[model samples]
Target chain A: MTLLESRSRTSRSSHGGTAEDSRPGDLCLVVMETPNAPHSEAQAAVSDPPADLSHRLSVLLESIGRGDQAAFAEFYQLTSRRVFGMARRVLIDPELSEDTTQEVFLQVWQNASKFDPKAGSPLSWLMTISHRRAVDRVRSSQSSTDREAKYGASTQDIDHDSVADQVGSRLEAEAVVRCLETLTETQQESVRLAYYGGLTYREVAERLNAAVPTIKSRIRDGLIRLKTCLGVS
Target chain B: MTETNSGRNGRSGSFGDTVAVDLASGRAVDLAELYALDALTDEERQAIEQYMSAAPAAERTEFFDRVRQARETLARTFRIEEQPPADLFDRIVAQLPVQGSGPDAGTPAPPASGHIAGGQFAPRQPASGQPAGAQPAGGDELAQARQRREERRRPGGTRRWLAGVAAAAAIALGGVGVGSYVADQNDPMNQVVRAGDLREASVDVAGGGTATLLISSSEDAAVVKMNGVPAPPAGKVYQMWLIPKDGSAPVSQGLMDEEALSKPAVVEGISSAAALGITVEPAGGSQSPTLPTVAAAPLGA
Candidate 1:
């Protein structure tokens, strides 16, 4: 893939359909004779999200603790890109990522109080939220591929060193990577396949032809080593 | 058995080893790993989440330091790799109304006490009105709200959440109805089983050990597609039929599309088709296949 810094301040309108035009209102279009749908279409109308965004989201999320909206919109702007990126990375569909971003934002709006700054930074918390949702989407969207295959891509394609790079262009990033370098080859390999690639510990086991316990141990040891490398006690 | 950990009263189970305070110092394992990868099991993840929730303030900053490192590294990958669609944020920010835009969304003028309790900003009142929010409800409010909900509904009533979902679904569907056709809208199961969520129904075809049916549609015809190795070949093609679970006469849904015989499709009349089956028939498709071989997966969410 070409290297393009994702510095989008705002480009959702370019997706073509304007907010007024994007009402998911018409179910007759998205669903057809599919059975067991609620006998009526009335049950299909999800609440429409409002259309306006120009504030910093961190501010909005802060207000959300007090049940604020402007704060939410601002939070949306600041975080939507990261949220969408995280979802798309996992789900592999821009449209799905967009939808997932919306869902996560709505969730953030509703659960703002749950955000505890003392726990982690707002961005980190948001990343966790998006990550969890994306994982769910990939799991729920399984088609002909068996669950095992569905989960396989998440593992084999992880780009580890870059995660450190994304956080900031600081020495801390280098330090984390440096620590990663300290692990035994097997331990490091296991960690890369699992985290960045999104593979389950079991799939890693099958791919490596090693027993599950060994894989688990390698993961635990790899993480411990990583923790030490990052200078965590 | 996995060890059962009943965390202080009714809290969810946690996964990581509990760190004794002195041992919990930040120099060992990095905190960023908790959110960095998809490798952790659901249980392990939930554990990390719970721990994060309860983690002390000092520990959290150390964790974010690791997350920032991960972000720095993650940033290097891309053609908008993890970039948001341009201006998506600006558009979202623009739509927010001016009032109620602050930390409290500019706090809606608190309503009368009764309505206040129900107000979106009403202080969450636990039990007999222990004010859920001190400014906004505090942790006590959350606990009290849960406690009150438990008292009113029952402890950990998974049903309340489901009921709330059902009620919300009804109100939403009611608003969209052609007139107030709120027939089965009250039915919880109806609320849960959406057409999009419908799972396919299936039965075995002759020598074919297993066949999965992919059911889809147009306003006109219900398309039924089957995928299976198939049983011993009869002289003719296998015909498809709809056997309604309600025990109605078998409706001739239609012949399977030849392309669909290998893949999935746009079928008609499927919502009404209760159970699906396949039978050996003349290439044109029999009014009813000789025998419904395998019943296909159920359709309708």
Candidate 2:
């Protein structure tokens, strides 16, 4: 189904139609078929950008801000999978993740005019929104359930969640893991429990048998350390 | 003031001193980063958010960037490969408020109801170091500028704006500076502060100081003044709430900064509130007041 859409889209665009007329559905169909297409190919058919993928995304976002539907479609085609994948990992429920992704993109469509290139890279901006929305869904739903129900009795389980193994070996992901490895063991645990486990500092402290203040400081310090390691200015 | 002296303070030697001052000031400079990563408790988040709403743009920006970077780093660690339902993209596009289309082509341009389209506040680097409030250009430029500012006002836009404003406000926040930045003349806040026929209500703070609610004669807006209230302790911030006369949920008015203790903060959208309530909360303002009201005043009285 996607292939037919892509072929029709390619032919349509090639035959005097503006590239902007092609839907993202068509773009992704083509993108998914490209292997070794560089870890960061935001636009296919365009020459591969050398380490300037962030720059391309920023430009595309700027165009989207101007009410360019084509730019938005291109963005959606390139990024929806990664966005959905992030939602899935955090929400841990496929159905909920789908809903969150839908909402996230809806927000993107409604709020694309709000993207500021100077703030950060386009991917980070979108991911930040994706993370926040997914977490909100998790927290609101978790409010009705027992908080202590998810993590078992021992703190040892904090380190053993299979979620960590599921991380892809993309260069950026590898770099993150490398930077994460630089933290002290306790800092690593605190960050993981808070970020991946989606537990608040108080809960992380409870799981680690430490004070809440201590957990807060650990997470803060750990993040600062991670920032420096990641070379984020 | 010499390079040698500056270097020493820049080193880890002065790190302890800096931490002590931040703590003594009751500022959660550290927790601001944690709050961004969703690592803090509700109370902590509220406190930090309150601090941030009034914090210097440089500080807020630094923290926001750190948080964004932290999130981006953590995001890379997610190894899943799930795709959203196929129709999701189409659904999003279908719902978009179509732009530039005729009456039948797309959704009519959202009523230019002056409602901020929001999510636009990606802080631009202000070349003149002017307050962000003053430079909102009129007409098309104004619309673009308003959209930018409104972005920060949107959910999820706060963190994003905090980062943008950091860059935009880097010099501007300093020009407006402590105790006066929020008072930038262009903000609606100024109208309430200078409102004619104002009324007043006061409540004593249990921690220390007094909080006064200054309502405009028309009761459309309010300016809150805090006196002698010490900086909030770690993991906590002072949040203001508006309780409707009809017993509806309290509407959050935003975090009250430490500076507001020494000055006045105009609470937007509170003229109709039956009473005004202040509570200690975790950094970002709460969904509802989490702690008992530390201070309360009847607005109608």
Query: Residue-wise lDDT of candidate 2 within B75-131, one digit each (tens)?
Result: 444434433443355456556675533332232111111122333332222344322
The C-alpha TM-scores of every prediction are: 0.37, 0.48
Q: Which ten residues in a row have the lowest lDDT in candidate 1 chain B?
A: B165-174
Q: What is the interface RMSD of each candidate, in Å?
A: 16.8, 19.5
In order, candidate lDDTs are: 0.42, 0.53
Question: Candidate 2 on A54-155: residue-level lDDT in tens?
Answer: 555676677666665545555665577667766755666656777888888778867777888766667777877887787777787775133344423324
lDDT of 2: 0.53
Put down candidate 1 lDDT per residue, B1-301, tens digits, no spaces.
1113222223333323422221244222232443455555576556555666677876666555655544323322111223343223333333333332334332332222211112243321223343321111233342234334433643322222221211111111111121122325342222322223222222233443334333333332232333233432444665566777577777664554343354323344666765566666666777755753534444432
**Most accurate candidate by DockQ:** 2
Model 2 chain A: lowest-lDDT 10 consecutive positions: A16-25
- The true-versus-predicted C-alpha distance at residue B167 of model 2, in Å, is 39
How close is candidate 2 at the interface, in terms of C-alpha RMSD after superposing the true interface residues? 19.5
Give per-model CA RMSD. Answer: 19.3, 23.5
